[model samples]
Target: MRLIEKVWFRGHPAKWLLVPLLLPLTLLFYFISALRRALFTVGLKKSVTLTAPVIVVGNIGIGGNGKTPMVIYLVELTRQLGFKPGVISRGYGGNAPHYPYLLKEDTSANIAGDEPVLIHQRCQVPVAVGSNRIASAQLLIEQGCNVIISDDGLQHYRLARALELIVVDAKRLFGNGFLLPAGPLREGRWRLNKSDLVIFNGSPNTELWPRKLTTPNAIMQLTAKVVCNIKTGERITLSTFVQNNPQVNAIAGIGDPQRFFDTLSAQQLCLNNTQSFVDHHAFCLDDFSHFNDNIPLLMTEKDAVKCYGFSQAHWWYLPVDTRFSAIEQQKITELLITKLAV
Candidate 1:
């Protein structure tokens, strides 16, 4: 799968021969996506609404755009404003009973998906996952949640929302700007104009649309908060880890492993070995066999979901926190208060 992504992004020669067939398939997908959105817009299909406002954080492109951290940020922001925020997810890769189930640390990623489990662990708030987000939202509300944050529901139009936040990878913005099979977009770049807000995960870029959330919105920036040892449960600054490190092994099973790798490098930590796993990969004993206790193993918190039972003393996890500019934070607070009022 990694090879396929590399080849596709690199414009491998094999893609040219397949383009004849892929072009038609891509067009079909685009049309179907557009038609679905059209149905909801025209009132032909009903979208489920909640008593409280639903703020959806999602992307048109496939893979991660720092949605977990963004969700955590929103949760904290709403909590500060005295609103109880709950989270709902599709549990994309999980195999739960398909009914809305509340999340716990012990909940397997196989049942709640890695992202939802990570959110549940970090936010310490109500979290539910199922195929039907509307049902999940209802469950959270019944549990006394006043605000619902749907993770990665931008394209899930069946779930009505009061605010929409489109998270984009500043580094990989709309890869080639073509629809699926041709490129990475599930929706076209023009569709972004409809979003209530646009968030660039990394540094801001001028090539794409300017960063702003509509309907009393503001621009937020992200930065690493802290890194900790998964096995020892000790906090370590990226600077200290890099400076005092013996040989180290870096492992990342997130949407963009390179970004995490780059962060480590910025602190002068040159990984003696690096392993990239598919996003949300279930870590097993064998996955860590390559490195012995002599070498420290570092990973992201999302990857830590599947690695909770790991007893290896050398393992560490970095917890990153996202912070918005002062003005942006104020705007988000005001928006949530306004929604609660409504």
Candidate 2:
């Protein structure tokens, strides 16, 4: 594991020694971020207001806190409530030649990004990606998307948002409460107060967040159901999967790999070996050469996208869906309707 990762997630005492050296840089980051937000607030930077209500599901920290799954859930709820929703993303790690690339059913993950493509595939909604979020949302609007769901744009004030949902990792929640290199937070903990609804990605850790933001509107749990073979698109229940492959090599290239591992453990999947890579790590065929055909390789739905072309049948990805209480769902739906007045 990386040193910064240990400081951010594992709470290693010794790894925090770099705080003194990084504090100056953190201060610089904070000043710049605050200045940018102030500019937007002062009308120095104009925000684009879309015709449709833009609901932004994002996090205050740098890495993923189940934003993609939350986006998928919102898309489902919006569709059920009689709204045509489209998703826009920053397309991190994708190297598409053009701006505002509208994702197709057959768009490669390398071009449209793994998360955006995955959203398009699972939600069956129009997805557009670009560095400029406003451009991406504009493309979606042109495609007849009535409601816009921005994948991760809480801090992207360039696009005026009707509703903001901030998802925080319940366990890691704002490590050390410092900004940037000194800690994990992209913005201050107080930023949560500005969100329309704060959501804990899992069970809340009261000690992590400040007293006020700790009280989340709802909590989300990721429930893994079936393990699917990426190469052949064959899915089997966890119980049935263990019957055949009792021990498997589990790999995750996500923001929080241990969370994925813990979820698998909860599902009673027997993992013999495990490996984690940086979030959005580009995978090549050589990355899997060490694994033997006899050993089944298990991964997450996000990682499966980049490996689908060159992976073998032994490679399987467990697809997880976001789950929350019906009461919370009703509350969110009601809030959405009230805000957008749909």
Candidate 3:
């Protein structure tokens, strides 16, 4: 998988062999994508205009581009501005028994997907997950939310959005610059200019972006917040956990697992080893069978939700929050205020 990914993000000999086979499929993807947008633009497809203001947080390419963290950030920020904001997501890997499922105390990641469950637990706000963004958003409005934040549905033109924010992985910006199989993008780079704001994850310097991304943009940093024992419910600061070079084994099942590992390494954790799983991989007890019970195991908060049911005593998860520099932070806040006010 990593080698195939190299074909998309970086130069690979495989790209020569793979691109020839994938180019035709890529062209087909672009045609379908372009036609889809054209239909919406021509009014052949109707877009649902909701009562509450809708803010869409998404990216052009697949994989986690810090959309979940941005959604969480907006939820917190809006509440501070006296707006009751609720969230809606497509629930990518989840199979809920019903449509527009509002999260409850008993909701599992398997039912709501990892991100929705994490957001609901972390923000303590109403979150509705389903394939239908309109229906899921309506549920949030029914819950008395004045604002709706869609997790990742920029391409879902069926739902009319009041504000659009696109998140980009600063390190891997539009790998191979192709759509679908030939590369790692859902839409072309041209779409970035259409968004109200372009957010760059893992990057706090906005000047580093390319000229083509002409929209107002901001850099986002994922800062580690709390380290909590999955089984004990005990919490500690991230700094405290890494004191004295603690022996930690890092594991991640996220879009960029290496990012998580790099974060831990920056904190000076003496990691015994690391494991990377496919994004949103379901967790079971047997997955950790080889780890020594004496060493502490660390994982991302997204992974924590799925492992909590059968987590071991030595297992801990680190929760991270999105952050921006003071200047950029104010810029984003002001931008949101202006856009949402409309």
lDDT of 1 by residue, 1-342 (tens): 464455445566666565555788899998898898889999999998788789999888888688888899989988887889999998877888658988875787888989998898888899999888999999999999999999988888888888888888787676655688777788877667787777777665554554442333345555665668777778877777766785678899888798888887776777889989988787788888868668888888888777778657788887888877787777766766665564
79: Cα error in model 3, Å: 0.4
| lDDT, model 3 | 0.89
How high is the CA lDDT of each candidate model? 0.80, 0.87, 0.89
Candidate 2 CA-lDDT value: 0.87
TM-score for each predicted model, relative to the true structure: 0.92, 0.96, 0.96
lDDT of 3 by residue, 1-342 (tens): 377687987779999999889999999999999999999999999999999999999999988678998999999999988899999998877889999899998899999999999999999999999989999999989999999999999999999998999999988777788789898999888888999998889764445436556788888888886799999999988888888337899899998888889899888888898999988999898889888888999999999999988999989999888999999989988887887893
Taking all chains together, the TM-score of candidate 1 against the true structure is 0.92
Query: Clashes in model 2: which pairs?
Result: none
Which 10 consecutive residues of model 1 have the lowest summed lDDT? 210-219
User: In candidate 2, what are the lDDT values of residues 1-342, reduced to their tens digit?
Assistant: 567878866778855587777899999999999999999999999998988999999998887689999999999999988999999999988978798999887898899889998999888899999989988898889999999999998889989999999998887777777788878888888888888898888898656643565434799888876889999999888888877766788889999899888877776667788888899988998887777778899988899999988989789998888898999988899989988888
User: Which candidate ranks first by lDDT, i.e. highest?
Assistant: 3
Q: In model 3, what are the clashing residue pairs, if there are any?
A: none
All candidates in order of lDDT, best leading: 3, 2, 1
